[model samples]
Target: MDILILAILIATGTYMLNAKEQRKRIALLGSHLANYQIEKLMEALTDGYLRALGESTDERRQQIWSLLSTTEAQLTEQFSRFAADFAKEPEATTRVSRLAMAIPFAEKILPSFTFDMRKALAIHARGIAHVVQNTSHLAPKDRAFMMTAELFLMQHTCHWFCKSKTIATARMLARHQTPHEQLVASVSADTRKAYLTLIKGG
Candidate 1:
């Protein structure tokens, strides 16, 4: 009877340990799935932004605007969901890092319209990069993930910016005006300043 009781106690202990391990594994899996879903949403937003920029004709641009607006709404909804889900998890650092990384991509995907719009987008992008850099220092692994995300984010931003700028410049050429280099320069300068401020924690 003594031996049987000891064995039962050991078995119960072993079961509890295994259950704890399983819980940890499930939590980790949940975190990974959340990250994957956020990344997919970001990609969808980027694709929609690119599609909007590709529409050269005014009528097409209008249609693309509607689509892009809807995409933006969807992206916002996804982010909100991510935030709520992440709040219930222990991996707050990872969640914050993912959000920081996603900001640059979100800003990049915004539609460029007037000079003001371009400037706002550039400034916002720089600000987000700055924030990411600052927050990433707290978690090295998360920082690495953010850096990887930012690389692709910046690439897409530059691609869209260059294409849109070219079209604008061509249109200006047809109007017999020098391409508005000043506007680009000013916006670029503002973006750089915003990035510097972020780095300096200003």
Candidate 2:
């Protein structure tokens, strides 16, 4: 009976500590994120893509894509800056656990199971820049597909940092209708390679 009570207390304390740690990371990220309209841009691009894809007339579809091209460039520039600034943060503070579940002090306790988020953000930034800069190299359909995958994958990492890999994966499916594995597979080859390396602690 006494051991059971002790175990419950320990579990409760760990949960509180994990939540507190997550809040701190979220705040640190939010401070840099507040400077950019990333979420709004993402939403606009997503809706624009859908509208453009649904239009049957080539002329109207082309017009919609033309309008969204500017938005793509703007989002790319903003996210790149945000990633760069966030990377300036020390790696000690940016360590993310590879564990699927949130475990208090897991990052510190299992050093082998942690990865630096600075590298992850750098990977995402480069991926977005490549998709935007290679407009001529990729068809419109291909570009939109790759960009959506890249953004969803990036969002997954942000959620992972603030929460756990499990929660991140669940939210990705719930909000974007995309599974975590699908997001990884759908991203560009360059992104897939670099992101895989970073997450694997390479």
Candidate 3:
């Protein structure tokens, strides 16, 4: 009877260990899938923005505006889904890091475009930076919700700016100060903090 009990205990321990390993594998796969989806979404946005810039006429601008609107809708949907997934699996640090890396790329693309688009992109980038900095304090589920809301706002604003003809005039009338430069400085400060934390093994 003692031998049988020991055998049962060993089997139970093995089952638990196997379950833990399976969970880790599942988490890693989810993170990779999330990263891939985000990259695809960013590429689509970048392509749409570049196509808009390449167009030389107002009719082309309208077409580009439509494309941007559709892209924004898609981004909103994707962000919502990501938020849900993040909520379900709050321990996915790899997914969070992947999301954070996309912010800088988005920032780089923003400055390559026109004045109005650049400013709008800068605002969005700053908001994302804010989300990244604050996320450390948040429960993963809450962090995901916050990030999703910010992205949705950014997409909505992008669609509005792209579709509106008056934005060009507004861009002309607005102060020509370099907000993007200021945003970069701010982001660098946050990056420094992150680096320091990493070095300290925090």
TM-score to native of every candidate shown: 0.33, 0.96, 0.34
| Alpha-carbon lDDT, every model | 0.41, 0.91, 0.44
Model 1 TM-score is: 0.33
How far does residue 189 in candidate 1 sit from its true spot (Å)? 14
Model 2 residue 106 CA deviation (Å) reads: 2.1
**Candidate 2 ranges with C-alpha deviation above 4 Å:** none
lDDT string, candidate 3, 1-202, tens digits = 9999999998787666545644653464356345436546655755665566677887886677566555555554554455444345333222211111122222234432222323334445555556545635764334434454454444433322322223322342353232322323333344334423432335
- On a 0 to 100 scale, what is the lDDT of residue 3 in model 2? 100
Q: Select the stronger candidate by lDDT from 1 and 2.
A: 2
Candidate 3: where are CA atoms >4 Å away?
1-36, 90-202
CA deviation > 4 Å runs, candidate 1: 1-37, 91-202
Highest TM-score scorer: 2
lDDT for position 60 in model 2: 96
Tens digit of lDDT per residue, candidate 2, span 1-202? 9999999999999899999999998999899999999999999998998998999999999999999989999999999999889989987789999999999878888988999988899899989989888744888878888899999999999999999999999999898889999999988999999999888878
Evaluate residue 193 in candidate 1 and report its C-alpha lDDT on the 0 to 100 scale: 56
Q: Write the per-residue lDDT of candidate 1 for residues 21-131, one digit (tens) a residue.
A: 435434653553456354565566556545655767777756765664454445445544544444454432221111112222222243121122233234444433443
TM-score of model 2 (CA atoms): 0.96
